[model samples]
Target: MRGPRTQTERDDTTVEIVYAAVTGVLLAGAAFALVMSPVLFLGDVPITTLANLWRAAKITAVVVFAARICWTLRRFGRR
Candidate 1:
């Protein structure tokens, strides 16, 4: 027979579940951005120009942020 979970165990499980959910959401968002960003590009602007480079930087920042969020969430989930 299985024993009932202690309060601390229940809290830990809840925290782990939340972390997993957050990581999943972040990964999905990152994947969607990766797929859609190029399709919504700014036409008429050359890729080598400052304006296009700035757009690229913005997308890179978003991807980096999402990756970091997922990394942190996984680290916490393992605790």
Candidate 2:
């Protein structure tokens, strides 16, 4: 049974949440771009293939984003 958080602790948590969100978005974007980069270099790909790649990129981005946020929060909480 932990006591209520102090003001500083609450502030720290808020900062951590924002930090996690920012970093998560950046990482997710990078992952998405990396996954979709092949589309940029391959000019003759079929539309279906492009669609599949886009889907994969979106999935990768979502997974990366969630993973990053969870990782950041877990790491911060241990402090």
Q: TM-score each candidate.
A: 0.50, 0.94
lDDT of 2: 0.97
lDDT of 2 by residue, 9-77 (tens): 999999999999999999999999999999889978999999999999999999999999999999998
Judging by TM-score against the true structure, name the best candidate: 2
In candidate 1, which residue pairs get closer than 3 Å at backbone N, Cα or C atoms, i.e. clash? none
Q: What RMSD value applies to candidate 2?
A: 0.9
lDDT of 1 at 69: 63
List candidate 2 segments past 4 Å from native. Answer: none
Instruction: Specify the poorest-scoring 10-residue window by lDDT in model 2.
Output: 35-44
Candidate 1 local lDDT, 18-62, one digit each (tens): 776676566656665664455468556555674565666567756
- Residue 17 C-alpha lDDT in model 1: 65
